[model samples]
Target: MKITFLTVGKTEDAYLKEGIEKYVKRLKHYTKLELVELNELKNTKALTPEQQKAKEAEMILKKITPLDHVVLMDEKGTEYSSTRFAAYINKREISSSATLIFIIGGPYGFDSSVYQRANDKISLSRMTFSHQMVRLFFVEQLYRAYTIMKGEPYHHE
Candidate 1:
């Protein structure tokens, strides 16, 4: 199975970009992983929150294929312990040959259509983090999840 991390816009902070790249490189030891960035909407000051999300959703949906199991990193979504998350990924890996697409939406979050298309939603924490920060956090957790699954020492219970 392929694991793809799709996020909106660029990670402009050099520090954050470094951290995200580190995890992305580490993850390659486990599975087929890819990171995709969707361009940020231009002149968003003119658009309403709803309009911004709609435009973002159009780009997001266009990248997803029917064979993908879309998962969104959402604040209101279910939170999981590291072990449980590892198990969840294991289950999905065994169950489907589809691509596992995980998305980190923009500042305003996702559109209703994005929600509708998602196969599942997961929350990294109850507190909010900047959308850019979430990309690093998510990739780290994904690496941790693999370690947990393989009985590796990378993650501690």
Candidate 2:
């Protein structure tokens, strides 16, 4: 199955960009991974947080299809160990032919519509990180999952 990493904004930090790229390149050997970064909403000074999320939701929904399995990277979602995450991916790949889309919403988080559309939700940690930093962390975890699946040394207990 193809995996799509979809985020609401760009990774502006130079260091974060490099880190995300490194894992993305490494991921090429294991699965078909696509990174899609939607442009951040413009002129947000007048918009409330809820309004921003609604507008962002419009853009996000347009990119997804009925056939794609959508998973939101959300704070209140299920938390898993590295091995368990690997197993989750493996299960999806075995059971579904749909494209798996993992979304990272904008600053204020996801809208109700976006949340309603999601098939599952996952949390990286209880502690919060900047949106840009989450990009790096998620990609690195993805790489680690693949390595663990292959019985490689990149991940250790």
lDDT of each prediction vs. the true structure?
A: 0.93, 0.96
Local accuracy of candidate 2 as per-residue lDDT tens digits, 65-115: 999999999999999999999999999999885899999999999999999
Model 2 whole-model lDDT (C-alpha atoms): 0.96
Please report the candidate that would top lDDT against the real structure: 2
Over the stretch 1-157, how does candidate 1's per-residue lDDT look in tens digits? 9998999998999999999989989989999999999999999999999999999999999999988999999999989998999999999899875799999998899999999999999999999999989898899999999999899999876
Q: What residue runs in model 1 are displaced by over 4 Å at the alpha carbon?
A: none
> Which residue pairs in candidate 1 have backbone atoms (N, alpha carbon, C) closer than 3 angstroms, thus clashing?
none
TM-score for each prediction?
0.98, 0.98
